[model samples]
Target chain A: NAGVTQTPKFRILKIGQSMTLQCAQDMNHNYMYWYRQDPGMGLKLIYYSVGAGITDKGEVPNGYNVSRSTTEDFPLRLELAAPSQTSVYFCASSYSFAGQGSSYEQYFGPGTRLTVT
Target chain B: EDQVTQSPEALRLQEGESSSLNCSYTVSGLRGLFWYRQDPGKGPEFLFTLYSAGEEKEKERLKATLTKKESFLHITAPKPEDSATYLCAVLPYGGATNKLIFGTGTLLAVQP
Candidate 1:
């Protein structure tokens, strides 16, 4: 299994720019998530999808958006990006959607490092 | 509020030395506690998952034990390959919502 794959391993964006970080999984997972990690800090959730056609905001969802139109893809959209948005972004998925009652383990992707100037 | 904290911030051990890392957490409900290893510039690799207090899991030289309020990862006669940042995370009750709250992590360096 390819597990989780994220596109654009690295990117540099100017203030006010817009971009989308793509995340895909081949394990046929029903749960997918987006998280950001800053230097010397733990990860903060940005958004997540329970399954195709369902998305929800997480701890830190400001200035970002997400779409889960298909089961295999959960893309994060950054609109009018700022320096505060710069961080190492990770995409993760799990075999099952624990549905507000489960604690299934999640598998992660290598990540995408983005810098906003 | 649910929070996870890892102690010793960092540790340096000789190849034959034995040591344990700590993870203290506070959550209304714990679905599960997780352990992960992360190498520099790479994503975290899953290690073990502990579902209940008094539960334990082992892999190679690493052993993870869990309690209601904390968890411990004991490294026995660790090798240089064990040098990596160890992260602890929690799956809070009420969801497999794909969200895992993580600690800053403990950086362990095993010298040969």
Candidate 2:
């Protein structure tokens, strides 16, 4: 199903540069998320959307922006990158059944590795 | 605050050795606990989801057990192919969004 896909497998940017990490899923999931995994820090949510045209901030949202213009795409933008932004970024998607107490499990994409120098 | 922590940060064992990895957590109310396997340079693959205390799930040689306060991933007769970082995550009750809190993960290295 090509479950989830992300672009720019690896990137290096000078401080103050800008870039966007592209993510897409073909699972017809209603929920999509962006997370960054720093060494030894696990994965932290950067942003998420419940459906197309809806986006919200997560635990660590600063220095990042996201837009969900289509059901299959969620892109993360770095307006002005900083060294602290260096990390591995992952995109995940899942479908939740209505009236269910628990959300469905998420499937992840091979992450994008970004380096800010 | 909701939090998840995994123990031994890293482990190494002979191909046939059996061991367990621990995931301790703190949350207002538990909804579900999850386990995932991640290989180098790849995204995490979902393993199991435990909904309540005493819940257990198994796949191949790995078994996951959940409790009121923690979860465990036990590896039985491991193989080199089983070497990877094992991650634990939780979904707390009352969270409108299905955001999961993840642990740093326990890196497992199985030697043949």
Candidate 3:
């Protein structure tokens, strides 16, 4: 099973151009997340969804938006891309069972490298 | 606020060398600590998860131990294939959804 898949493994964007990074998981996970990893920095959450049609802002949500229209897909949108947004993006998902004690071990997809010029 | 810090930002070891990578963390309340291995140009791969102090988990040549305020990933008889950046993350208690705070990670290079 393709645990998680991301589109456009690499991309070059011009400043102020907008783009959307696609992420899909076949694990039937209920929780999905988007994170950006800068050089020598830890992954920073951009957005996440609990389930279909439910999305929430994370630590670094500015300049980014997300939508979870289906259980298997969560997409991150950059309305106005900036050089600061140049980083490696990762998509991850995990399944949570009620009363099972928080076991949020996430499965990540190959990251998408974005460079803003 | 929850935070994680890893020591020796980078390490280089020859095959058969044994070493330990440290992950120190601070959180309101700890729920779980995780270890992941990430190769260049790829996303992190889950390695081990520690739930409480004194809890330890092992896989192949790697062992992870957890304490009240820190976690340690011990590597024994490492091989070149074991080279990767090891990441540590933590899930805090009292969150509606489990969100993890991560460390900068320890990059390990195992030379044969």
Candidate 4:
């Protein structure tokens, strides 16, 4: 089903440059998220959306912005990139029904490797 | 604040050897604990989910057990194909979006 897909498998950027990492899911999930994994570090949450047109900040939201204009797309924007932004970025999605008592299992994309010099 | 920690940062085991990886967590109210397997240059693949103490789930050579403050992932008669970074994550009670807080992960290398 091509569960989840992310564009730009690898990228390199100069400091102060800007770009957007594209993510799309075909699972019809209501919840989508963006996370960054650094070497020897846990996956840190950056931003998430419960549904289209709804978004919120996560644990590590600084230097990143996100928008969910459609159910299938959630894009992460990096403005004025810095070295600290060099990391593997992952996009994940899940389906959750409120009050259903079911645990949500997140499905992740292959991830985008970004390097800022 | 919610936090998760995995032990033995890295482990190397010979073929057919057995071992366990540990995940310790601290949170106000625990909703669920999860296990995922990640290979090099790829995203994590979900393995198991434990809801409460005494809960256990098994898949092939891996079994996951949960407790009040920690979780254990046991690998039995492991093969080289089982080598990967094992990650644990927690979903706390009262979380609005149900986001998971993940650990640094345990990197396992099995030699054939």
> What number of backbone clashes does candidate 1 have, counting pairs of residues 3 or more apart or in separate chains?
2
Number of the top DockQ candidate: 2
Write the residue-wise lDDT of candidate 3 on A23-90 in tens digits. Answer: 99998899999999998989999999999998999999999999999999999999888999999999
Model 1 chain B is weakest, by summed lDDT over 10 consecutive residues, at: B91-100
Q: Higher DockQ: candidate 3 or 4?
A: 3
Question: Model 1: clashing residue pairs?
Answer: A100-B94, A100-B95
What count of clashes does model 3 give?
Answer: 0
lDDT of each: 0.91, 0.94, 0.94, 0.96
List RMSD in Å for every model shown: 1.9, 1.2, 0.9, 1.0
B23-75 per-residue lDDT for model 2 (tens digits): 99999998889999999999999999999999999999999999899999999
* Model 4 docking category: high
What does candidate 2's lDDT look like per residue over A1-117, in tens digits?
999999999999999999999999998898999999999999999999999999999999999999999999999999899999999999999888567553568999999999999
lDDT of 3 by residue, B22-78 (tens): 999999999889999999999999999888999999999999999999999999999
- What's the lDDT for residue B23 in model 2? 99
For candidate 4, write residues A49-106 as lDDT tens digits: 9999999999899999999999999999999999999999999998887777566889
- After superposition, which runs of candidate 4 have C-alpha atoms over 4 Å from their true positions? none
Ranking by TM-score: 3, 4, 2, 1
**Proportion of native contacts present in model 3:** 0.81
DockQ for each numbered candidate = 0.77, 0.91, 0.88, 0.87
